[model samples]
Target: MSTTTAPPQPALPIRGFAEFLGTALLVIAGVGTAVAAPDTGTLGIAMAFGLALLVLAYTLGPVSGCHVNPAVTLGLLVARRIEPAAAGVYVVAQLLGGLAGAGVVLAFRSGDPSFDLSADGLGANGWGAASTGGYGLSSAIVVELVLTALLVLVVLSATARQSNAAVAGLPIGFTLVVAHLVAIPVDGTSVNPARSFGPAVLTGGTALEQLWVFIVVPLVGGVLGALVYRVLRGSDSDAASQDTPDPTTRAGS
Candidate 1:
């Protein structure tokens, strides 16, 4: 008699590639809209990020869980939903994708004589002079910390049960929309480190100078959010029981 072995999920590289493509598309749509349509104001920009993420959640939810954000990867890592190696791969891919996406935006914007990387700057996240609302550093930190926590909590909670998978993207995406709506004025709404990395690097100056805040703060928020999820959902016993990630509920951030 032969016993059957369950099949493993897709290879890490495949998942990493999906993350890369997803992140790139997200930046292209979200950042592109923000830069090109500044006249449309905050509502339009928030919707762009939210809608792009909503679509990516469904399209790439199965392949590699569609993290697309370093903060999200960190959140899953804290929740024990993903391994360290896998999370590292996801972060690296997301960073590269963000850079590529910024490049695409730059290419398009360059076509117009009025466009200037230094003057106009990429849609990079920052506070003080870099902030659209002229918010200070303290304000920036507080908003990022609180909003990132909420975003990560939503990601973990919405994807916790298998039954939630079919409809998880809606809440997840809406959470992002709400996050942006509230925080955009504070620091350009960088709950995701990968989303900030690309434009900041390309734009340089203050965005680059304050890059560490965006990267470090959101990751801390991810961990905090995971801890909150554990407490609210009866602790780690449930998540720890399954040594491997559950395929039914594909986790995305």
Candidate 2:
């Protein structure tokens, strides 16, 4: 008799590359729209992000779960959906991807002689006078925290075992769109730290100064969202127990 083993899974590096590409693509479409077409208004900007994520979710979801956001990765980590090492790699990949995406936007803008990085604001998130609506730091933090928490909750719920896997991207994308609609005027809507980091780094000055708000708040929100989901849906151990075969039935067999 002859037996064959299953093929090995893709290495972490390969998966991380997928994350990098997915996030880079996301920033390109999202930030690109904001830069190239400012008159598209709030709905268009929201659609840009939503559509980009929806496409990437299907494109790279199988390879890397299509996180593309550090907050999402952190949420999955707290939910025990991913290992610590893998989570760290994913976050690093996302940050690098964000930078690359911002660079792409900068390159594209360079073609326009009128474009100025400092005055134009490369869609970087900010607050107070920097904010589009003049929202203060406290408002920015609260909005980011609540919006990110909701976003993570949607991510967790959409990817749950009981969810409709075939259509998970729709809900996830819609959640992001709704988040943008609510938070864009307030702080350009940075539910993902990596998303904010790229533009802020490139723009510098006020954006960079306020960067900490986006980073710290979204992370806290991600963890809180995961904990809330775990509380309401029961722990992973509970799911495992439910899946385990009853000893009495096994013994009867």
Candidate 3:
């Protein structure tokens, strides 16, 4: 008896659509939570953003790895999980997705009674007096750098290692929860440059003026995390070793 083999499945264009939609949902839900429930306070805002990431990641993980954050892409680049060209593309997609999400939020505010875009700000990050909790520039820098490092570290370990691939999404999402829990009170928890860029472009005030901190610090932290992960993973050895296991085989080929 002869057996027939099934044809390989072609990737659907809808997967790309899922990427755009998922990131938009993330930004809208996260920023909307902050806007609608400002009185709910920092913890609430943190949870909003965290939950957004969690849901979005699960929804899009199989399709695009759910890299809604530019810093995460940068981290992946540093760890050599993706090509430099791919990292640049991911960052651009994330920024565009974020802008779309923020635009939706802006539309919602147009008819609200208390909607003052200028006063409320666009959820952009800042430092010193610009910071939500009066954190200074230097203090904000250190806090953002450290927290972003931790965020990227979690991403690197959870997603990059073959051992953790099966359950990576849960830990990765929870990492964002933890990062937001710590950083929300400082700079509104902007570990993602694309997240900050969207709102700052819309607000066009201090949010725009202080956008540099949100972009620069998180990027620096991402690269640092990538390098650290590469060193720890013994990446060069894995690449250079002739005894490396073939991914499709259970034993040495």
- Give lDDT per model, in order: 0.83, 0.80, 0.69
Candidate 3 local Cα displacement, residue 202, angstroms:
0.2
Clashes of 3: 0
Give the TM-scores of the predictions, in the order they appear.
Answer: 0.93, 0.90, 0.84
Model 1: worst 10 consecutive residues (lDDT sum): 240-249
Shift in Å, residue 134, candidate 2: 0.8
Tens-digit lDDT track of model 2 for 52-102 = 999888777767778899988888777777778988998899999998999
Residue 229 in model 1: lDDT:
81
Error of 3 at 94 (Å): 0.5
Q: Rank the candidates by lDDT, best first.
A: 1, 2, 3
Which candidate gets the maximum TM-score versus the true structure?
Answer: 1
Candidate 2: what lDDT?
Answer: 0.80
Error of 1 at 130 (Å): 0.9
lDDT of 1: 0.83
Ten-residue segment with the worst summed lDDT in candidate 3? 244-253
Clash list (residue pairs), candidate 1:
none
